[model samples]
Target chain A: MSEPAGMIHWEAQDSIGILTLDAPRGNFLSDPEFIAPEQLKDLLDQDGAKALVICGAGKHFSGGARLDDLFKLAANPVHLAERMNKGKSLLDFIENLDIPVIAVINGICFGGGLEIALACHIRICSEKALFAFPECNHSLMPGMGGTIRLPGKISWASSLETILGGDMLNAQEALNMKIVDEVLPQEAGMEKALLLAKKMTKDRPRKVIRYILQALRNYKSMPLAEAMKEETRMFCELAYEEMERRKNENLL
Target chain B: MKTSFKTLSVTYDDGLVHLEINQPPSNRMNSLFFNELSSLVDELCKKDGISAIVISGKGRHFSSGADLDDLLQKAVHPEKELSSSGTFSFFERNHFSFLYFEELNIPVISAIRGVCLGSAMELALFSHFRFCSEDAVMGLPESTFNLIPGIGGTSHLIKLAGLAKGLELVLHGEMFSAADALQYGIVDKILPRKEVVPFALEFAKKISVNYYKEKKTLYLNSAA
Candidate 1:
């Protein structure tokens, strides 16, 4: 589909949805050019959409938030807060999607771009992919939940140093830190992601897939007692369904 | 020191808790085995005398994983056997046992030999350190049976290894050797089958010493 200049583009491929970040200015996320929370939610809500693969349009995943836009927003504290909240909401939506989301990273994936990747369920990056939280270098911090998510992926010490030191991490380092899932050659990155998406979504019922994802999230977010209670309920439900199917097949 | 358990043997010696999976040839974990493990873990947690724990298996394999025959029988009428609270749910009880093992203050190491598959490997994941025999085979094969690891295998594996490796292991259900497990950062050390337990015990002793030293230092600092 055709899009206006500097607008995010997305299209459906079978059961997979690909969301591309394309901006005229080096794919640097700015308030005016970035994909909105509503647009992302709408894309995910599409009929028969089982998975999504997010990637950058050009050489860089993103150089991160534009400094000029930051400066302008800095002048208006209220506007900056609003924009930050919106960005957080967008990332939150991506993270909580029922279907799996894969971030196919190539070239630069720093700051806000890296935040987007972090929000995805799985991340596959090119061997040459570069990651960093250079917000500290600009006397700012990641506003879209990077600080919260980074510690969960890597050691708190490493996260602290990476965010506070404003240093770039190579793809191998990212893999070691458990930040990115797999590191492939730049040419093979997107292909691997699609293969994974196809493998995860193929032949899996939507209800089963939704249950698996929801249970995992509940285990993470809810108290142990409540999560275990729900897990037991789901397990019994699935087991009952399986038993029913077996009995029906026996009759045939 | 509890010398006798139906499927397991426990011996407490000089602050080191030696627990062994004693079922023959292929130590198939069953509901009874799990029940014993949970009770043992609860007792182990309460004792201040314990410094470290080294868990291993007797005879050929560490474990063949869950006894599928037993599991199937129970799952068929889970309300009668596997029920917790209302009826039907394996998640209610043994989870706390695994969590307690993972959350232990002192070091816990698993000395793995031969096969450590399915829930057995998941148990090893709960340990702070895992030392396996060079010829040991390890994997999570739940997907082969059209099931997921009901316990914390998925979560713990993803936490220890990366998300990709976790997905690959769980989805493909491929068995990896000890060397591969080491390369993948699953197990810490690989030893000869005969030396696996000795190595684990030695490592445990070292960790126990270090733990006490750290505790002493903390105490001194707080007093000062």
Candidate 2:
């Protein structure tokens, strides 16, 4: 893959796709004003991608929802309702993408900005970065599913406190909370992440990865027995898929 | 309608109806309390000359959470569920009451002290502004109950602190200090518990003056 001209920059190396959220100047948002979710989904779905790195082009990653756009939505209730559905669809796409995605946090991580990254499997952030999810103060919740997903990654108690208190933490704090995986210098975050991505892709079982991802996503709200059933079903499926892959390799 | 007041106390002071919790040390929530609160805000949103609303608590702590005591009560008295009429459901009450701070032509400010937890956090969140004492240790612990913030905690906390910080609190249910509250823009100030009452009154009075101005202008326009 190669870079596009305007909205956002897309590139690929070692089968690891890189998306630069330049237009929104941070983590690109799902809005009419900037890189729409459809455009991003299209890029992600394109063939020949193994892993991906997402970073912002400007000084910040993103501030979350375009408040100006949100205000417009708030003013027009019908329109807000329609657009919110679109937003949820986009979030599903980010979460379900087949390849492992990593967020390269360069600066401030906020609102939807933090949310967009949370969809990815891996997160590499700059040590100097500041991150926050200040949605409650606006009298609005994370419409894009932050409430459900974040609690699973961190403790449920932490997620509740964050959503209610609305306090931002630094990169070190985020690392301690296990919110982000690794923290590097602002300038080195991308390079190190790309290196890690390349390492991850080697000898990786893509099928196992996808199944585990789906299993986790599927069992989120279900009872323990149901979740166990799902896990067993997925584990058998993974075994079958691995056997099929081995046979294909032998034939080749 | 006769209210079965077992959770909170509704009182009147200086032309404003004050809603204060009586459950002492920590006014943990009960269904009865939520039911009455929903009804009170509904009834009071109408009525005459109630120009201001102040939500506070008795004793040291504001509110702890869904009273485990109350939850156990519900398990026993499952038939006592309230049929809320002309009232926004629990979540809606948390959301719109803050709007009511401005909408009902009154300024509402919650004077929070000691430990404010779970739905109590929502109270601070929706109050348009919050006044907390330096001794207060506040946070949202709903996740421990195997739930997300249903009462506008997510929406309000995110706007108050920003997304990352918001995520942190909701994820951990960690308590924050008055200084941290100030740092995160959670509280307007950190005052001695002794000063909280007077400070809130004066602050409420100051904002009341502005509300009067805006209210008059709207009336003149509508009447014209």
lDDT of 1 by residue, A124-166 (tens): 9999999999999989888789999999888999999999999
Write model 2 residue lDDT over A129-180, tens digit each, in one string: 8888898888878877789778967888989888887899899988878788
Error of 2 at A68 (Å): 32
Off by over 4 Å in 2: A1-102, A106-252, B1-6, B72-102, B212-224
Where model 1 places Cα greater than 4 Å from the true spot, the runs are A1-6, A36-42, A45-47, A70-76, A136-139, A155-161, A164-179, A200-208, A223-233, A243-252, B1-4, B11-15, B42-51, B76-90, B209-224
Best by DockQ: 1
TM agreement with the true structure for every prediction:
0.82, 0.50
Taking the tens digit of each residue's C-alpha lDDT, what string does model 1 give over B65-144?
87765654445444444435322545456667777777777878899999999889988988877889999999987655
- Global lDDT of model 2: 0.65
